[model samples]
Target: MAENTAERIDWRQLWASGDLARFCFICLGILLHATNETMVATVMPAMVGDLSGVELVGWSLAVYEIGAIVAGAAAGRMTSYVALRTNMMGAALVYSAGALLCATAPSMPAFLAGRLVEGFGGGALVSLAFVSVERLFPQRIWPQLFGVISAVWGVAAFSGPLIGALMSEFLSWRWAFGVFAAGGVAAALACLAVLRGPAATRQRNDGAPLPPFPFATLACLAVSVVLIASAGVDVTPLRSSLLLAAGLFGIALFFGLDRRLPAGRLFPAKPLSLATPLGNGMIMVAAFSVATVTFTVYGPLLLTSLHGTSVLTTGYIIAAESIAWSVLSILVANTPPERERGIVLAGALMIAGGVAGFAYAVPAGNIPLILGCAILQGGGFGIAWPFVTRIIVTAAPAAERTVASSAVPTMQRIGYAVGAASCGIVANASGFAGGLSSQTAAGVAAWLFLAFLPLGVLGCLAAWRLPANSASPAPA
Candidate 1:
């Protein structure tokens, strides 16, 4: 127990002794990762038009997601067997190389290869990043440090696209990739001095054998390919069905491997076991609720096709949701626990409302209404995330905390993948017409599909199962 305590040290001393400068740089790396993901979404349409690879547009994002999920899952295991410094540095190097490929790639295949590499690097960085809080801080201070980390995400959510837009408009979309590469290199070097200082690797005995890599990678790849392929309407139903079947089969096989891993490992022991029901339920709520943010795709398409708005205007409108989400997140960190639950539940309801508000958008023909609905939805996202995240990380037994922490991202990735695919199907079936559809039909679909979000209200009810006394004290 003493040794275990040493490994998962409490939060107070860790925070006090933590190198703040290191935190700043690490947050910057996180910001860059978020930026790359959002920016690519904004710029990819333009890039596809320019590169004439319209057919491959969906694959660009899908491939990156595939790489990231595999990397994140693998990183959890690697953390058990490797020095923290080695994992951090290795991921940085790999990510940087991937970014370089993206910047210089002359063909669609090459760019995809680059995205794949970057995904691995980005995945590893994110999966292990929160563990640093565990390593550096004691338990009492975990919530506070986690709040700081959450703030970084809020900032990245808003700024990434704006930055990407400027890069795409004034310079070239290629510059977006180039800038990330430079940032990745600088982050790697900074960590080398502060994090990877010598002596540890030379002493031997990192941890244990890494789980066999083959099945995990294959399963992830299959899932990503199927999801991406489904986005194209041209694929025959027969082919799509086959791909979907193969992907599901692969995922089933991966889980079989997951069961063979040790305790306090694989899929966050707490969530998997239903030990932290409130946290686990809320994370699942987040999965369904947050999907509404993707409605931004409708914003641009609406502006350009229906309202005759320019690209710049569309960009600002799309950015409003992110900005709203960012600002509300900070406010949430400071909220009291009783207030936090109410606020989070309210947020889920609001997300549902905002999604339903999509129906109002077309009838009113009011852009401001659309924006207002987005902000309301964004606020819900902002409030719910921090509280749920706090609960999940802190609620578990110390021995299982690492696995618990890991489940948050794992659930998020799987959720996002499923959400994107499912939403695409919903939008298509409802006659969304890409971005050019009449507001009336799009609004109805948005409302109907969003009905799934309020279903998350069920999570709030489940929170009751948590010990009545089990609540965090008011935020300082």
Candidate 2:
């Protein structure tokens, strides 16, 4: 199948004839997930103030991501066994319940529980959204459809924090949670209305029992994340180092156990090997994700402390990255086949330049330069992501297409989780653990971004290695 449809298909005609209602519902799943993430991020400070859980604040994000990672990994297989509509509706309901829990929680522990549940649902929503694209759309429209989804994320980037801030300031942070719950309920109903029948499932039953859940691997992965997250707290240096090491060991063990599993493996064959296109593309995704985590996780704090920027301005600056991504993705979604490899390589370079730009601009308190760098960084991902995703999905064996589709976002999330932890270690080592004074904040901002430079370089190398023709058949 030709991955590039620009030469043959009219995008306008495709949209005119396509099921817009179903597409909108599909996009809604991811929109809600993305919006809720930024909203929670915006409102967290207020939540902490009310709940009095300053010390346990980090765990809120940690637990949510841990749940997301696990649920995202499982979602592909789950869809194979259950109807897509059923899975999506159930996920939306779970999300709604979690939001209600958050709105009513009086203590930090209760709030953490809600976040975990919310993470699981949000993770499933995102992964399943990709799967829906595969199942619902013709191959020719895949890139354009992905472009639309990217645009939705761009919209969320602007609105999520605004809604969160508004709720936090006037209506109370709890109302923010209530609002998300309402969105989830609406999304659930949309899923019920739009998705129909067994055709939405990944595979038809052939009288074989459903495979056992990958419980052992999931447990290992979850524990690994928890350990790494714990290292970020005010622990002793020796203890933190030990925790990180242990966490890495657990991750290694997970790969080994997953490889041996007879069924329901988390990834495709030789998924970690760089020899295959799928593996290489995934590595590129993960490496770039790790490299960018410094900005998403710490940009607001560093910008506010060093540059004296308002919270809202810092957020929009950070959001410039997503805006750039959406714009660039829409521009190149239908690039001619011959131009893709060049675009991918160029995008990777742009990302690396953006990271380097941040290393200088952020610490120096140059807001215009910082914003410009953000656009470059986001634009880089925007340019390359659709192509990278299409390549990875097409290269997977037919039986594993669902897994491959989910794995892209799953890997990105895992990268974020791991990168956040690694940054925590670096921050502690560089005097950020003591709290951010102007001097300490400047030093931390520089080193934090500089630390990820090598990862970005690795991503560039991986992008270079991607096969020139992305539409080649999956390797046996």
| Winner by TM-score | 2
lDDT of 2 by residue, 1-476 (tens): 46544357576677677555578788887888788876665565567558854344445666777778777767866877788888888888888888888999999889989988998988888878877887777786677787788678888986787777678767898998998889899989999887774567445456777777889988998888778877866768799889989998997788788777757777776676788888889899989987887776667666766776655666677667777888898899889767878899999999999999999998888989999999999999999998988888888888878778867877787777777667776766676666556776777888988989999999999999988887667754
Cα lDDT tens digits for candidate 1, 1-476: 89767566444655567555556666666776776876675565456546644344445655676778778767756755677667777888888889899988888779989988998998888766765656644466566556667777767777776776777778887888898898888877866667743322322345664445545544754464555346443444675566556655665555555655554245543343444553555454544433553454334433444455454545565578788777787776777665755665676676766766765663355778877877877787777766666666667666656565566666666555544444444444344423323463345344434544554444445443433322743221
Candidate 1: which stretches are off by over 4 Å? 1-18, 52-58, 76-86, 105-110, 131-148, 199-233, 245-264, 268-283, 286-290, 296-302, 305-308, 334-341, 359-365, 390-401, 423-476
- Model 1: worst 10 consecutive residues (lDDT sum): 196-205
- After superposition of all CA atoms, the RMSD between model 2 and the true structure is 4.3
Q: Count the backbone clashes (under 3 Å) in each candidate.
A: 8, 0
Error of 2 at 213 (Å): 2.3
Full-model lDDT for every candidate: 0.61, 0.79
TM per candidate comes to 0.75, 0.83
Q: How far out, in Å, is residue 304 in model 1?
A: 3.9
Q: Which stretches of candidate 2 lie over 4 Å from their true place?
A: 1-19, 44-61, 76-86, 103-110, 127-151, 165-173, 189-206, 393-402, 435-443, 468-475
Error of 1 at 79 (Å): 5.6
